[model samples]
Target: MKQKISLITTGGTIASKETKNGMLSSGALSGDELAALCKLPDDIEIRIVDFMKVPSMHMNFHRMLALRDAINKELEDPDVTGVVVTHGTDSLEETAYFLDIVTEDKRPIVVTGSQRSPQEVGTDVYSNLRNSIYAAANPLLENGGVVVVFNERIYSAKYVKKVHASNLQGFESFGYGYLGIIDNDVVSIYQKPLHREFFSVQNEIPRVDIIKCHTGADGLFIDASVAVGAKGIILEGVGRGQVTPQMVSSIQKALDSGTNIVITTSAEEGKVHPAYDYEGSAFDLKERGVILGADYDSKKARIKLAVLLACKNKIKSSDFKY
Candidate 1:
């Protein structure tokens, strides 16, 4: 009764190569090619599925929905013990968490990417790919939701973030560390992220944007987003969800126009708080109908907002709990 691991390849640094100008995720390395370089154990079967050939930076909400659909389709096969996605590191955390929110089956779905291109000296691609498959195959992770694997650490997608720009060590789970670590092809489990509700991937993807607060920031971006028909916006306010006084009116206008807002802080470690009393403080924003981003960074907040908005058909738009 041998089981298989569905290896889905979505182009990223793991499949990139060097060019005359610079490095690009040309996707020359398919899943089969990349897996061929790995010294896989004979106990598990690996099945390659080439889904897309685009860099991670090019990923969007629509593609994420499509990716979720593809993974869900594979889960229909009982023989598929687990799944691995080779992606680019740029937006790997976002994609991982989005899938985490939408995937319901709970069998381990692990995403991995390399900081350096596959052609680089000492590229981390091989180890990342191998570990991803190992993590996916491990029965202990059968219900672990979605996670990112790199540098031997297993990070829950909800808590993970890219900590370094160009390090082989791609991400960290912030205050939560990692769910577990894998050593010598062995995975040890200690804990899992605080579980959140998993929404079914919806039929249509919507426009959700993140607007960062800067000095003298006007609410112009919010106005612009609303003007362009954005379904939701994640306001990355200055520390503790504080925005300038000038931006409050813009935020209000967007809210009045029926655009949902989630307030997030620039600080990395804490949840958005309504501590200050100023015009654009989280307190003020909440009073004006903005949702507080609980421990979610701007990117993650945006992802959640999109999911809730996209699945509005089944989940009443007004009854969005998160």
Candidate 2:
């Protein structure tokens, strides 16, 4: 019998078309329409599910939860072997990480998106979609958790990032490196992420904001974030997560005022080292009870924080294991 794969569509550049006004119009194609372009083997049974038809830049926490629900529904079917998500590249990494953290299933949940539109001469939608389907059908991918396969590279959901602006090979893993690669129909394996089951929110939603630190930056943004009733904030600081003196004061004030703060590096790779000079900005901020975001980027860090905060009332800080 052929292996069964479910293709869930969440609009991105792959499903967008160029309009007369020279702008990209999304939802130009349906799930079945894109699936028709792929050439599949006889041993593969592919099914299309149209989940969302908006650009990934417009995707939010609620939409992510919807996608999770869709995946869970499909997984409940005994015949489904794996799942593939067609997403926009803008926030693809963030959604992938969210799924990796919240999803309990061990089946492969692969996310793919195209950098170029289907109307382009060298559009990569066909190849990317084909490869995504192929990856989904492979048995070895079952235990890998959530991953993003693009530009012929396979990256873990938590570490994959969109680095290039318009290149076909825009996604790459940062510091920890990719889990493995797909070469000549073979899915090789390397490092696997630690399987930590984090709880998801069942009730209220949490709002998170990202604050970047640059030279001569002040506490204005932080003050405004707190005033706006933000539940949590992610600080994208310079190397090793160092912020300006003014921003440091703002972070401390925010923590003092009952807001949660997560510190992550603005750099592409490496973890945030809080052991650096205690007199510096990072140390001062850490002393105020700010949580270390480790190697998570600002976007992923924000998502993680939002999910945690949603369940804050039920799960205590000690139960908060990320």
Local distance difference test scores for all models: 0.83, 0.81
Quote the lDDT for 252 in model 2: 76
Q: List TM-scores for all candidates, in order.
A: 0.94, 0.93
The alpha-carbon RMSD values of the candidates against the true structure, listed in the order shown, are: 2.2, 2.1
Q: 193-292 in candidate 1: lDDT tens per residue?
A: 5555688754576888999899988978888899999988988987778888999888888888788888888887877777888778889988888887
In candidate 1, the residue pairs with backbone N, CA or C atoms under 3 Å apart (3 or more residues apart, or in different chains) clash, namely none
Best by lDDT: 1
Question: How many residue pairs clash in model 1?
Answer: 0
TM-score of 2: 0.93
Clashing pairs in 2: none
| Ten contiguous residues minimizing lDDT sum, candidate 1 | 313-322
Cα deviation at 25, candidate 2, in Å, is: 1.3
Name model 2 segments beyond 4 Å from true.
278-280, 313-322
